[model samples]
Target: MHTRKEFLRNALVAGCAIPFISGKDFLAGARIDDFSFTSPFIRVGLRRTYPAFSFFATDSLGQGRLHLSPILTEPPRSKAFTARTYRDSISYFNSPEDIVADWQVKCEEKKIDLISRKPGAEPFEISFSRPQNHATVLGIMREGQRVLLPCILHLPGLGTFIIESRVPDATIFYDVTARESTGETPFVKLRFDGAGAKGTVKYSMRSVTLFPRKKKIHRIPLFDGYRRNFINIFQLNPRLGMLANSSSGDARASTLFLYAEVARVTPPLTKTFTAMDLIRDSLETYISGKQGYGHPGWSGNHESLDSRPSLIIAASYYIKSTSNREWAQKNYPAIKKWGEEMMRKDSTGNGLIEYGYSGNSGSWDSKIGPANWWHTIGFGHEDAYSNILCYRACSMMSDEKIFPQDEHTRACKAFAEKTKQHFFTNFYNPETGVLAGWKSGDGKLHDYYFTFVNSMAIHCGLVDKVKGKEILTKLLEKMKEVGFVDFKSGLPGNLIPIHPSDSGSKEGFQIYQNGGVSGCFAYYFIYALILCELYKPARELLLGMMDSYAKNEFEGKCPNTGMTRVWKTWNGECRGHEGFLADSYHALLVVEGVDPKIPFLNELVHFLNALTVS
Candidate 1:
């Protein structure tokens, strides 16, 4: 049990290492033994040896709240250890497991623990175990933390390994060597001098392997100079890859976007086989009429209109990124079927898909009805965002020569062109000086000057250069007028607030998709600004966003959410059903100019030129 003062201090210092408590118990009457501090990545359980002190730690996967254990390996032999506390010293007798000798530990509040196996001899000890100091040195190494160790083990066959057992800032000098052995177990004699003291330690080791040491050679020039600042961003792709692969075949917009973003950056890091498996499974779901619609929460739903297009886009991206022609060729028929299903949405032959009164079909999941992605507002019928994605998907599939260049490919190309033209003509709202979010069957524009819709149009090249510049400039001006220039809170989803009356769900203004700033949506806006050559504003917003991430300000605004990852909303409100919408981190790479098509396109051009020369 931690004292109230100690608990508060640990809470402040631990950051994500605090265990997430959901019930009313909340840390009151909580025991250290009640929680299992296991690293999800390594699947290793961490236990505190003394159980009196707490050390905050995170696993390789960044899942924090792990306890530090003094015992490194699960030694083969176990011996009972007794702990007794005295006025000046706390001591432990016997060995917890088969080391070379049993440990007699003397713990004090102000000084390092004096550990000795032989009585009346130089006491081997560990520093930085003082209760008042909270510097972490014993637990598993997390990113951005200095490495410190209490012991170093040298096995007969294995190399020497540092064992973290205590938090110490002082330098340690070790003169230790492993004894040559032909037996199953090996022993090592250890002596060290540190902090103006000399000591001897010993260890017996079983078979163990050390963590591999390798120098990471970057083959891509994407992060040549800005490596250190972008380390977290680089790590984010693999984390997103895990989430994308763990979708259990649901394949919703959130999961698809996560997969697409990871695929865009580095294909091998992504779980390509798992994603392809899920995509194939999702195709069956779509065919079975179980997933074309949308559902609530993280579970598979098909009610949303963008779901089908999102799957196609994700698959196309996977193919383009991985150059997995076999997967594409094998699934070509299914892919065409999915594309045909998307085309069925555009019943009017106008190239733009119309949302029936069924609901909003975009990505924004609101408490209201079936709106598109911007769920709160009335973005139904023909949505600018979904249509742009549809056009992009169509174009990607048509350009993909992995499949035969037949009538299906020709139709896809033709449809993509039609979608582009129709979207530009219909979605743009000159009255609002930006693209309309959606246009209904009545042909009236739901023109709220949406930031995402307009920016995405620019990003996907749906809007021409002149129109894109004008619209983006107007958006910036409006955002400035609405006081989004400071961006202290977050980038607004829309320049103008969504009126309750105009919203299908009657959602109030200035909350969520109605007007709330979304970090996920803001990425496209920033990318669009870069495309439009609005460098100053783009650079300012990009730096501001990075600063927010660095200072953890995004989660600060919405403290109740307990969001440690890139959130869906800029203010950290979990809007996308899932809490960590990993795609938001994709914004960081966009400033580096990550275009998934460029490499593939370059290869295609080279191949074509070679064929022509031949």
Candidate 2:
């Protein structure tokens, strides 16, 4: 058996290193504090405290609430004021009409400043003027004669200032404002009056750190810029193992796909054992049909095809990415069972799984829509999306080097290729030059130019370069014609709108899955574009998505509740039910190369590329 040091050394040589630390040390040092501060733009935590006026009367034993409000907005109802705790301090900021003033807290010292922006921009302010219009008030009330030192920190375009109580017996009240006056550049002003304290006090603004300082950082590989922000969203809920589908609940399959993808790309950033445990547990839960596993009422529905495909892909990815052959061998039985279950779904023997009203569709529960993941669509009876995933999963499992070389493995390999060929033959819409969303058993096609299915075809190597390029060109044309702007909201799932006649549900038209843009589905399309060598368009979409994510805008609103993390839909119509959808953002790591040539799950990409060429 290899010693711990030996194992680490081996891992280092493999270009990956597992940290050498005891479980206690790992928990104590690497664990993220749950009580960290968060905002639309950032999150921080408090490590220490300084002397401050107490907000409670004698023997008060509860936490004190600090309320902040932007000028021209109501105190509690305004969406402008967003805050979150970090490891060493708390971060608070007001983003009103796109003008942001990020405040950083460290112990008792606080720094506030406005983010610089382009002149005359729609999203951010050009100049800092009109202090009263942009002013923000920080307030805490207590019954006492205690004076609050430096009660307010004001940030104007020109400079920073503070408002404080000059008399010890005065109540604390102050306002921080930014304004532009005639002939003078924009500047900040402090308005003070309450608590016998009476005048504005000018102070110099100093540099402040907006992002939290990491005591022990785990750097993610293969992505940068706003793309990295996706990882930050995942970090927010570290204990959950799988990314929280929303603030309140965890969805299966899609969540697993996100976690597995992240782990595959940057193993160091993920605890492999912990992630595997979560995957195994979820699979067991699905298998056992037991309640109290957080996914109740889902046991009886076998038609919900997403969990099986998602599990197969995730498990295969983990095995390949980490080269953990032992894990693959150990879990081969369970993994094979999942693959067999997916294969058994192909009642037609034509190598595509059929979907019906038996259970949920893909990642979406039945209530959402008729089809799989694109829940609102009428896709069923051999879905291209689920089949593509099934093919990939089978191919990964059948790799002779990755698994035991046996008749079952060989059959799986042959079945994967057969499925790929059938996928192209059945789903390709020669008339539209794109893959049809799904082919019903009744021999009808739900052809809506589903962007995700086409993209996955290209990424998975089921489509040739010429065909892939043609499909993408058509998709771009449709997106442009529809007035679909940057990827802030994410790429629309389908190019053409779902017609009410084709959709069984009224919610399928121009809403939710009907044709609404979903970042969750966009990742695959983006990856497909890159895989097809559509460099310019791919980069444009990616950068546009990143810019949108940074702006954190939802609909026409400046910042929605899900802005802090990735939103499920670009339109911001959905909230906690779909917030922090990690799979959408995790797509960034799928592409890696000077011009983004490589696809995610590098080994799988290599395998599929070779298959296509051959």
Question: Best-fitting candidate, measured by TM-score?
Answer: 1
Q: Write the per-residue lDDT of candidate 2 for residues 160-236, one digit (tens) a residue.
A: 12333334433332221222235443322222221112322222223221112222111211111233243322321
Per-residue alpha-carbon lDDT of candidate 1 for residues 1-614, written as tens digits (9 for 90 to 100): 75533432332233223343332332233334322222221112212243122222222222322233222232222433445444433344444443422243332211223344433333233222111111111111122322223322322111122343332432233221112244322211122322122333432211112221112212111111112122122111111122231111123442464445433543221111222333343434444554322444432233456766776777776676657787777777777887887888888898987665533323334354444555556667787777887887788778845456789878888999899777877977767688887777667777777877888888888887688889999988887676555542346677676665566554445555567654556677777776666765764565455444433333212345533323333344444333223334455455334354434223323432343344
Q: lDDT of all predictions, in order shown?
A: 0.46, 0.46
Structural similarity to truth (TM-score) of each candidate: 0.57, 0.57
For candidate 2, report its TM-score.
0.57
- Runs off by more than 4 Å, candidate 2: 1-228, 232-243, 270-301, 358-371, 554-577, 590-614
* Global fold similarity of model 1 (TM-score): 0.57
